[model samples]
Target: MWIPPPVRAPIGGAPASDRRRVCARIDRLVSGGQRQGWPWPLPPSGPLGVGRSRVRPGALSVGMRRRRPGEPLEPGNAHQTVPPLPRRAPRPSFYWSDFNNVAREVREFCEENGLVDERRLPSATELRFMPHPRPWLANGIRRHGGWKRVAERLGVRTATDVLSQPADASAPKLRRRGGPQKPRHYWREWKNLRSELTKFVCENSDSARYMPTVDELEAHNRYDLRYAIGLHGGFRLVARQLGLVARSSLIMRWTDLTAVAAEVRRVAERARLPPDVMPNERQLRQYGPRGLVDGIKQHGGLSVMAPRLGLRSQRHYPLRRKPRLFWTRDEADRQLKAFIQQCGRVPRVSDFLDAKRNDLLTALYRLGGLRSALERVCAEMDIAAVQRQDGVKT
Candidate 1:
């Protein structure tokens, strides 16, 4: 009906048989050959169909044996090739065998550029390279310019190489700063003057008199005349100016002068006379001796006797009547001493009288009258006489 089927032409003009052969070869390469009896061609047993087969009896077929748990089945010998593993690129080799020569080149460069002192070149053993010595050298050179400049920059006047150098025979010897100088003679003189002044001030101060109060003499008997004399230097100088050495000496003797002056002042005050007027012996005798013996006996000998007599008052008083009068202080003193000696001591009022008697008599006699007068006189006179006479003796 329609035009005969379009005429067919072969592309690449290959025959079907050739294509089949090519496909067969590819199948053999990929899958191996088809199995004959055991899903693989068993090797031929010996000598055509003989009595005993050559194949071993217990041997396992490829399909019957369990491929060891995870193992892959063995491939046919023709197809058993492994692909190679990927590999890393190799590193380039560093040409370090020329290191010594490179070091030599560096040394030559340093010498040419004045980067180091040629004569002070470090030995090869000493010139060790750090991991990157060139960068360190470049940085050091940038910072300090060169080795000698670096040493100067670091305040090193003498190079380390110079320290290692032999000592110079022609160098000048160093002279050390000398020791402290001795003090001058005037220093000693000044010290001596200071010491003398200190001593003068200490000895001449008013405190040195040891007279802290006017009553000081009553407590301390030893007056320091040397200290008092030193204090009188101002007066002595005035006296000396007036050419009165004798008078100055008299005044300077504080003990003698003070005593005489005290006595004269007392007498003048009592007489109501001017200090220029002196007292005669009679007046002094009459006024002075009247109360003195009693005072001494009462105050010095029997100060404790007052309380024993039941007298509460500390006031001094005269005997109301004449006592058994001793002729002298010496006589009174002797009698007191003898009384003290005789009684094996003087008997106290408390010793002579019991407490009842002391209270009764003290109250009765203290009321005034003859008993009061008699008790007063007894207090003034020696206890021995009062005991013997028992009343006033004419």
Candidate 2:
């Protein structure tokens, strides 16, 4: 037997010209497709049966036109045929006749089930699970309106329909949960918070006079009361409400010296300090009752009061110093010159403030004001004089 070379379809059937035309049409459908670009020229959109023809490397040899069952094979490719592209099904649209049929079925089903389960109507999900499921009924219901509106139009009773029967305008709307509104938190109200604060202070503090700090509140895990404090005003206002005096207010007020002495001793006892150790005024203020430090001050100050409470005087207050004599003119000029040299320009009042030199500021004011003094200094140095920025005093 002779082994012949593989034979291809005739060139005239699916000719190169027809292939390029078909490929161009396909490229319009899918942009930048393999056949649409590279090596191949942008093809002319010629009708079937005419154009200059050329073969592509991997082109298929199917005839240009589809042949029906009885038609003879095309000329160029005798054996191969190109099936026509599939046509899409037309889009389904809402029609009254179809919708009425779907509605009639739904109504009949609802009527049959009504006696068994009152107000029974099939949901889309329920329709899908039925023995002879009708998908069109659900789709029709969706197209007409939502389930509720459709049910309402079809005389089906929803929960809202059963409940809103009374037409009284003044009738109170029912809450989702029955009964009066549930009691809000006590901290939500100032009066409630004050009472709660009284209880909290009495129970948690060393005595009735200690007000809890923010840190103490956080440590106790009662950060919720942070809201309470803001609603009722700050710690001092709250302490005043409770008949407790702030140490600052207590120091300024005159109270019985005997009571003050007694208060100091009481604070030392309950100070949260080491046992048998007495506290100074600072320590008593930190850990004792609100008025304790001031009480010590009222009874001849901390130095005198500490001995009575068996505490060593901490000598905590800053010692007073005499104000220095005003700076001489020469000294003032020397200082201003040095400052200008460092800055390379006349410095502003803000520069003095930023450097924390209020004493130098006082000396400048005393030396006949900033500009007058700086002008004298700048003149002596043979430099250009500077004026105060925007000159008029605020």
Tell me, by TM-score, which candidate is best.
2
lDDT of 2 by residue, 254-282 (tens): 36666665655566667655543456757
Candidate 1 lDDT, 1-394, residue by residue in tens: 0123322323134576643443344334324333323232222233112222212221121111212222322444434333333232342343323334334534653454343453443222122322112322333233333444443444433224443421232222222222111122322443443343335435543543222221232133313322333354533452343343323222223334334435434644686655444444444445443333233233322233333333222235532332344234344344434443545633344433642234323332334532333344446654433343343222
lDDT of each: 0.35, 0.55
Off by over 4 Å in 2: 1-182, 245-394
Cα error, residue 258 of model 2, in Å, equals 32
Query: How does each model score on TM-score?
Result: 0.12, 0.22
Model 1, residue 285: distance off in Å is: 22
